[model samples]
Target: MPDPAYRPAAPGDGRRCPRCGHRVSRYNDARHCSPCAQALRREADSCPRVHESTWAEPEVQSAIAARDFGALCRLVRGHAQLRQEDLAELSGLSQAFLSMLEQGNRRLTNIDKIIDLVNGLGVPAQLAARMFGRPG
Candidate 1:
């Protein structure tokens, strides 16, 4: 969490946590203080994902957003009411392949496969395409 403007963050902009040296990138980048900043800088390569909505920033943030592959897979199975096995049956792509695609290790190809899954979910193909980066 950078500033309201998404600044790259600076040392003085943070504070240190006595319990942990990690810098909390929240509350407009000024969230953490010094010592924490150092610790965070040292071990701060990971972050959490946002899951409140279907998807956000379909284009610019997707590779990173791809982190939500599991959730998307869940939504496809749960909301669309398609079982992993059933999806496997229909897509001609293995459950493990689907899992990998859902995990972001692989990507979706053959736009029609996406169309099939989206169809099962009852979501419009165009919107699904945007989320999957196959939008025309």
Candidate 2:
């Protein structure tokens, strides 16, 4: 018996995935099989490190220098290519709170919360020191 998950390709209907030798539905633009695509997504999601160059960007530096937590959070989210949900998961902040903060509807004034955000996002220690007005 054939695999239930496997769909035999009809002409122009599907193609074999290059990565897994499995049928890729025509509707799936990525071309990888579902399992392969899911695995790729998992791998990408597993690493959320912000690139070193992201810290050097003028906007990021400005946000840090200004101590604008909201703007800094937004910049980090963008630079790290993370959704608010992902960032919330990492920072232990609620998604709604992060959205509000990003929109300037809320402020992150509490020192502990600031530390949590900095630590959760893995902001470089030197930069965190600068942000906190401590000599790095």
Candidate 3:
């Protein structure tokens, strides 16, 4: 992978993958390219703040930052109108883990895993923000 830091940064340029901050294929528009930005918006239910919040939160300073999956679950549950038990059964994530996530006691270890849950609930990545945070 090329070094994004070494790559030049400029206005209206594709910088890096905000989630992982990796240099995107197109650097002229920044990783928050149209596609990534749309993804972020969807992940937050068209609510950019939730997606934006992680960047400001203590432990979640970046799109790639660790998240409070528990809070995320509550959000998801509300968004999907599904009970935690139903989600647990559908995603095969243990009920305890689901409960932990609802309480913000744990965070997602893998985005793919969260994707599974999201898919099962018919939630869009826009709500998941393929890019977790905007790269500053």
Candidate 4:
């Protein structure tokens, strides 16, 4: 593969992927082309941080095995790839509130709040049920 660091044939022609050297349109000025960037994102997403394997950690797994929803909530957030601030933006909750909820200092007793968390974290319905129980 060509060196991504190689500059465009002409100085203003376009840019190349720093990692793979693939060329992309010059207008965007992105470091890596879209494809390469997507590939890198996929690679990063596959890491253990937010991947399924995170649920297998001893503490998280124990919480699942014991059906301890509060612990599960905390564990899930702790293992999530997005920071608490980012998650708060996605869930429309305050960071302090999310932290309190995750730490069990504040309860997640509201159905709406539970739904927001589940949607924001992409947690499956079955898993949410484990934490909040079924809605009447």
- Cα TM-score per model: 0.35, 0.62, 0.41, 0.47
Per-model CA lDDT versus the true structure? 0.53, 0.80, 0.56, 0.65
Q: Report per-prediction Cα RMSD to one decimal.
A: 14.6, 9.9, 15.1, 8.1
lDDT of 1 by residue, 1-136 (tens): 4435345546676644434766655453544555665667766543222232343334323432343434566555554456676667655567887888766688765667656655543444445555666433
Native-referenced Cα lDDT, model 4: 0.65
Give lDDT tens digits, candidate 4, residues 1-136. 4445544456666566677887776554456777887898898775433456665577875675555546765677677755777667667678898788677787666778767766766655555566555332
Of candidate 4, the 10-residue stretch with the lowest lDDT total is: 127-136
Tens digits of per-residue lDDT, candidate 2, 15-83, equal 888788977776665657789978988988796666677788788887887788789889988987888
- How far does residue 9 in candidate 1 sit from its true spot (Å)? 82
Go through the candidates in order and give the clash count of each: 5, 0, 18, 1
lDDT of 4 at 104: 73
Report the C-alpha lDDT of model 3 over 9-113, residue by residue, as the tens digit: 665665666676755555443445456656876876632122333333333222222345566556555545567776786676888889886776777778787
The Cα error of candidate 2 at residue 90, in Å, is: 1.5
Error of 1 at 100 (Å): 1.3
- lDDT ranking, best first: 2, 4, 3, 1
**What does the lDDT come to for candidate 3?**
0.56
